[model samples]
Target: MMVCIRRLFLLLGMIATPAIASPTISVLTDSLEHPWGLAFLPEGDVLVTERPGRLQRIELATGRQTIIPGTPTVSASGQGGLLDIALHPNFADNRWVYLTWAGHCETGTATHLGRGRLVGNALEDFETLFVATPCVDSGRHFGSRIVFDTNGYLFMTTGDRGERDRAQDLTDHNGAVLRLNDNGSIPSDNPFVDDPRGADAIYSYGHRNPQGVAIYPDTGALWIHEHGPRGGDEINLPVPGGNFGWPKVTYGREYWGPQIGEESIPGMVDPIYQWTPSIAPSGMAFYRGDLFVGALVQTHLAHLELNGETVTQETQLLSELNRRIRAIAQGPDNLLYLLTDQRNGELLRLSP
Candidate 1:
């Protein structure tokens, strides 16, 4: 790859920990348009999803971009469109690439999951696997991020689609984390598999616009973070059948003024970490390499030090870039990579 290194020596800001490493930032390409999700291909190239309803591949060696055809017809409205991308665990053998997007359904538009085989520059045999129910006409709050756990099971997240009351309803697929097999079948062992009132794919429920989900290394636990209305952005460790209180009980309030609900309730789960004044966090990743850092993004990169399940310290890095970091991934080389969310987005890489 032709990498041009630019050393950034901005003032280091710390919340509770020592100064973080000021890694040199390299802009791989600045031509991406609002890139949402990214997955590194086995051959060293990268697959990126643009929210404007297009899929493209980046040739890291030369910074060449090629559009991958056969993507689903997406509702490129307010906050809905082509979202997250993931690969099957045995991608080298199966060539299965999974995608999450907002698609038109019988009721309206909803988050959907589908997969296809990657053959050259196009996806062959594309199939729409799973579609969220009770779709609404609103174009907001599509919580769609994909991650595969260590058990080879696929997990996907969905938002309430702007209907906050739907989060508390188990009968619908909205506002929940879903578990399924790689082929998009609901797992028999899913928490709601036998419950007639709940969707068979739901693993956990009660979320608000969760745009980030990642498997915690070594522990295999699913870590998620969702955006609240006015404030109360939360980072949570979701368990099977777990109910994270949203409108029923939240640290956030309505955009107009009033508090939504009690901060803590009896049976509902509270967040492990929360942010008031809303950082508008999007993507999350845990780095176990040299720096042992956990990366979460707002306007800047938040480096969190994890002591088991507790966040011991935090440091904000790369605020000088002045770009909204939409997603972050730890590359195979153990370095950090980021996607800026803008019309003229850029794919950036950080090296220690």
Candidate 2:
């Protein structure tokens, strides 16, 4: 009982102290062009993907950017291009670098997952692993975030490609979170495995442009956030076979001010947190190394205090930057790194 009371008081304290101290922000480099995703190499180097079909390796000590060769030819249309990047859990031994990109498909474009070995400055033996199916020609809503959980299982997200009804379908990969083995094979224990009604790789469905996903500290729960039309940006903790309602149930409206759907549904999973005016959330990471459950918000860094899986308090930081913070990750040195979205994007480091 004492432990429960103490936790309650702690959460109250966090909510009461909303003005958390801001971190010291410094510009590491301003030379990046629309940097989308980043992964920290074991040797302290950073691999960043630019949306325009380019992969860059940045030497942190000297801020030198080198264009890594052997990237696939990307569609590079609207929201299509090189997207997310992640290293294999055993990358030190396997030297494997996995990436997600908008690739040309018969219909138009689809998000493709591929990997290659990093030998010297180029990706060698690059091969496409898995491709999202039923590609559509639309330029909007390609979610595409890659993450590996503690068990070494790979999780990737895909949007509905601007087709809202596709999110409710289980036969296609649209608007779904997929799980696979490190070798790109479907896991037999997947929620929809052997179920003819759904795709085998889909773990969760009915998301709208989810761009950020991270595993919760200690619990190993995978958390995700997605973009809503004019409002209703959401953060969700997805379970296997979960259905997160998008257009059929949302807190958002059309861009011209019309309701999309009902605010809630009987079977749909709702968000743990949501942004009504739409902060336009992009990338996210838990303060994992520091043992904090917080993550960066859209324009500001948000410190989330959680009691178990529930977010009890949220403190926003770094609002003064006034920049569209795209991706954020905690570095090896325990500092936070942020990528600003722009034609002339920047890499910023934050020291707490």
Candidate 3:
């Protein structure tokens, strides 16, 4: 394993006082090689995916980690490698685990989804489910995040490989949100299932390196957020068969600060929230626990504060952490867990 040095330390971004109390942050563990995603098992252990290509379980009680044997030989260069991890909706009974990663494609690498059964400390019956089409040599943009909606369908994001033109081409699988069955079959009701104009598995299109995907369990509303070029980081509510207008109608500009395209077009959907100067948003989760009260108590979308498809109030929660947050997951206990993107990624616990 290649080791990179990064230290995880405490940060109090907001000062605490008698009238206003800020959430406390604690370092749970460290020494993770750019940990990319996180999942909690039925037994209460937390699963982590290191971008360097390792899957490990961390004991919540002790922070002790056990490397789970049997991960695919992932392409671990650039922004590729092991990405997102999710358990079957019925994980307790079936023990099925799903993973999204970068794999060897026709010439270079492509985003792939696979599933295996976790038995003891190893994965068994591993199989590839889906591979994003058009293998590109670039290692920059593989937007691989997996989520299961209430109806038990899988949705995964695919980036455009930094190729701007392909995002506008429906025939290409790049830059789209795809809907598939648990077994990797295209969902019959997917927007493009019968349309010869686009990939049958695609649900929506024109995305730019989306890194976060989550479904509101109660509402079953799907939400996604992605990175913009320089400015224009955005959170979006994706609709079936809808066009998001990446290179054509983005609020972002080119790397050197030249405008990319118009800010709005007729058919392209607009983002609910846009961040200029790019905070580099990665992973996000809607709060689903009893730990939060007052401003969050039974409120609708308090953290990101989303009302339907729009964000009302947003707060900066981790400015003091001084690290790029790669993923966020709300544990069963309502405590929010954060994975920092670093050579030595740290597991952080945020509590009110």
Which residue pairs show backbone clashes in model 1? none
lDDT of 1: 0.83
Q: What is the C-alpha lDDT of each candidate?
A: 0.83, 0.83, 0.78
- lDDT score, candidate 1, position 67: 97
Scored against the true structure, residue 113 in model 3 reaches a CA lDDT of: 94
CA deviation > 4 Å runs, candidate 1: 1-22, 289-298
Worst 10 residues of 1 by lDDT: 6-15
Best by TM-score: 1
Tens-digit per-residue lDDT, 7-68, candidate 3: 11112223345454445566778889989989998788899999988998998878898999
Which lDDT tens digits does candidate 1 get at residues 148-259?
Answer: 9999999999999999989999998899999989888989999988888888989989998898888888687888888888889888888889889888978999989898
Ranking by lDDT: 1, 2, 3
Clashing pairs in 2: none
For each candidate, give its TM-score against the true structure.
Answer: 0.92, 0.90, 0.89
| After superposition, candidate 2 runs with Cα above 4 Å error | 1-23, 288-298
Candidate 3: segments with Cα more than 4 A from true spot: 1-23, 288-303
- Tens-digit lDDT track of model 2 for 190-251: 99997899999999998988999888777888988888888898888888999898879899
